[model samples]
Target: MRRHRYAKIVATVGPATNTPEMLKALFLAGVDTFRLNFSHGVQADHAKVHASIRALEKEVGRPIGILQDLQGPKIRVGTVRDGRLDLTSGERVRFVLEGSEGGKDAIPLHHPEIFAAVVPGQDLLIDDGRVRVRVVGVEAAVIEAEVITAGVISNRKGVNLPGTLLDLSPLTEKDRADLAFGLELGVDWVALSFVQKPSDVIEARGLIGDKAGIMTKVEKPQALDRIEDIIRLSDAVMVARGDLGVEIPHEDVPARQKELIRACRLAVKPVIVATQMLDSMVNAPAPTRAEASDVATAIYDGADAVMLSAESATGRYPVEAVSMMDRIIRSVEGHKLYHSIIAALEPGEEETPPHAVATATATLAEAIHATAIVAYTESGTTAARVARKRPAVPILALTPNVDTSRRLSLLWGAHSVRTDDVDSYEEMTAKACHHAQEEGFAKPNDIVVTAAGIPFHTTGNTNNIRLIQI
Candidate 1:
């Protein structure tokens, strides 16, 4: 089915959307990719879901991307005494590095990295900021903090430090096992959470090693300091706004989201705007106007894709959520201001033959009113370069490798097709025209601009463009 929009939809799979029939409905509803959140399910459970997705892909004969999202290391307080404690504002509390149960007088925090990184005056948000405290003193084994916000603190509540950077690996021991399992399952993408620095991506790269594309999760406030380096190292980036909103001020998230999207676009990498996109749809068949506007805002900001987390994974209306997101993207893309807004944010191109040719391909397609922009790529970079432009024309990306096609599923405007590689210009044009027409993107006498390297099968050589009349 052809979606009349550019931005793609990534749906998460869980109990609600795990059946093969439901998966097929989601795909037909316009889900280009599926995310397996390792935080919830065990390996055995995820294996079955992955198998079902593959079966659906075969049934539909369309490439579908699978993302293995690793649940990275988490920082939390140890067990509380009597299960929970009620606090009052201005009350002083003591935290010690221990593993035992805690009382009002003494709370246990097992992570030593937090002690090493935190200093006086930094705030610690517990349970997603329901309980807040300011660090008043730090010692070798204990920390004294003053309660700023009073709420019930439960056992094993998560800890968040907005200003301090902790010295810890983003990957937990469980993530290592999960990454190995997912890689063995032939997943196309791996999303690394709890990332705070570029070295975190480097560590993941050491393990991933070209097995799958790495999508860095920008969830920490400290990561914004060096987002450029992180974006450069990552194959893609996700605006994980859940923890991000907790770690930073709530009002700053919109600007931060725009900055991240623009940075990713400039780097010619796919960026997914994620977290609570359609929260109300998790229970209701329809979304609130504000939620609908939120999805449209991301599309207007030129996000490569928008993700549905719990809305699809565990929602009462999983298929409806995906369909609504599709409708929102189409509505926004058809809006009068979307084109100019994206054009205004068009990134400066690299001064090279490959990049210049990609830019010219988009321009020529617009000038000639081409039905589509066909990109013949081996590594998906050529298609990425063309997509960075956010042109008015749609993209038909043809690759010899199914992996490439699957990876392109997350790319904006990319209608991926896996076929035999074309070795010459004549073959490139014929194949491009055939796929464009067959895929319903063009008809005879319609213009389609095709871009490829002179020597076929050579990667990163986007140095040629041809305007073919279908």
Candidate 2:
């Protein structure tokens, strides 16, 4: 099937919409991509869903992308004795790492690394910030906190330390195993959640090899600190506002989200703005006006995709939510400024080394009135950077890996093709021209711009630009 012209809709899969019929209905409802959250589904269940999606793809006679979202190292309080706790304002509470053998007033924290990082005066948010506590004292295995605000605390409540940097690796054992399973299942994309540094992307890539594209979830404050490096390493990015709002000040999330989106655009990497875009539609048939505007703003900001979590996964109005998001994207793209905003966000000469080369190729394509710009990239970064320029002509990205090809389908104006990896820049350019001709993207005597690296050492090292005729 032809890809969506504007922003794509990524609908998550869940219990409410896990069957084959519901999956087919969602695809027909305009879901461009399916996100399988590994956090909730087991491997066996995912295998069943994968089979169903493949069957649907054959039925529709089109390629559909499957994104496996890995649940990274999530910190949560251990089991509570009574299954709940109620704290009043100013009440003193103690959290202990007692190896899951704690009493009624205490909860076990299984993560010793997080326990070691706790200090006095640090804030700990529980249950997605439904309750708040201020650490007042610390002992060997226990930390005492004074209730800053009182609320109901339930079992397995999520914990977030905004300013406190936990001494933990981004990937846990569970994430690594999940990633292996996803790659074995031939997932197109593997989204790493709670990405804090560039190393996280590197680790995930090492584990998944080239079997799947690695997408970093930017929801931690530390991720923003290392945004450029993370963007450079990641194939795509997801603006996960749910935990991001908890990690940073609530009022700052909006501006931060915009900044991340713009940064990804400059890098030419496909970015997805996710979490609660149409949350009310989970129960209600329609979203609030503010939610509509929110989806529109993401498209206006040049995001490659907008995501629906619960709205489509377990919502009563799953199809309607996807349809509404599609409409919102179309309306926003109709604005003249939308194109201009994308063009203006392109990386300039001073941005980064690879970005400079990508900009030059895009500029050459425009100046020569090229019919197509072909980028030979193994990592898909160069293709993404060129697509970010939003050149009027189409972009043909040639890759040897199927995962790279599928991932690039999310980018604007990019059509990916799988071919043999080239060892030299000359061969890369020649193959680009050949494919552009064969694919009918470029006609005889039509100008095409080709870009690649000198020795072609790495997939992301785009350093050469040449203008050629098909």
Candidate 3:
């Protein structure tokens, strides 16, 4: 079931391909992972998909990764009385805080937080910037605005006040409940969207408690500001280019995507490049040449996985999209520059503690001709560090938390196993050997490299390293 490849494909499940037979076809079509987007599907919908995926895993006799993407705090306007309204350019519009009957001149906006954040001369974009408005004045019960662009505003249209530091956390009560449901469903990975800082990852980790892997979606400017810390804290990362492109300048996204991919590769965490990989396939049976180039660039940039959004979820050609992405990845990987780019982008020895150890361990593993490298990790930090090296041998990461195991599936060359945390170095080595044998990763007298923290109790305290013959 395991393929000796560096890149993987993640396909989204939606109305177009929700049946067990369809899921099985997707799995057989070369999808390495499945993404269940909480933004669109309900619990019942997801349960069906999960059941189908599980059944397919058994029937195919291979481990298929499942990622449940939680819908983060999505800021939108409340219910519109008429369901739709037209705003003309330069028209003065009053957005009332109360839910009373208001005419076209005055519309009701329920969120007071947005009202408080609204200042004089702040641009407000609606429905991904189809319509624009400028705040003229702010009162206790309303926000007075003048329409800068004319468009039809519908019910619950998404509002984006970019660069206006709203006094709000990214995660809402809905996201918390969704996270709980995803964990209960035994999902392999849980992707938290609209993450702003490292604390978001910490809070999500505390709530999930290792039940599923936590992958933060780097979509905001604030997230990019704290990229290194966020990567260090999160189990894995997803380059969620959809909102990210909208949040930041479009030109910056390409460079930012490369930067994030390189950072995750160096950190050894699996990084997924997502959104619109084959957007045209939603209607067209094939992707545009530019879309094909976009996917190839992700693989050349050393991404662990390339994702399909609407292409697989609601597209008319769902299976074709997945199959195309798989073909593109394989084709790009065959080029000489692919390995060269990966090797050239490899992180050198740094002054940091974890980085230093990871670099040295990777070098040692290659030098000793080790069959496998076993990393006993509590916070999953050491495993990521090893992955950054991109060593030729497989990295078997033994963790006490099941969530950590699932999350590591995205990382390059990492195979995760759930086990009890070791109190001593000897136990760590013995268990590493035991799991290696059980997984058929190693045999008697096979050389294996082991790394773990010396204290063993503290999280992210990785330091110790050793070479052993299993």
The order by descending TM-score is: 1, 2, 3
Q: How much lDDT does each candidate structure score? A: 0.93, 0.82, 0.82
Mind giving the per-residue lDDT tens digits that candidate 3 earns over 1-470?
45445677889999988999889888777787899999997898898899888888778655678998988888777666578888899888888888744666667777778888779998778887788899999998888889998998888888877666666666788888887787888998889988888888888888887677778999888788889999998778999998888777789999999999888876667899998889999999989999999999998887888898888888898889988887887788777777667778886655688778877787798888998889888767888788777776778888887556656656666777778988886788789889889877899999899878888867776687899888
Task: For each candidate, give its TM-score against the true structure.
Answer: 0.99, 0.85, 0.84
- Model 2 C-alpha lDDT per residue in residues 1-470, reported as the tens digit of each score: 44445567899999888899999988888776799999997999998998899899779754578999988889998877677777889988888877664543476777777678878988999988878999998888888889997997777889998877777777788887887788888899989988878887887788877677788999888888889999989878999999999878889988987898888876667899999999999999999999999998887777888999999888999989988888788777777777777677654444677878988898888888898888888867888778777776678888886666767767766777878988875676679778998777877888899978767757678788888876
lDDT of 1 by residue, 226-305 (tens): 99999999999999999999999999999999999999999999999999999999999999999999999999999999
Ranking by lDDT: 1, 2, 3
> Quick one: best lDDT, which candidate?
1
* TM-score quality measure for candidate 3: 0.84
Q: What is candidate 2's TM-score against the reference?
A: 0.85
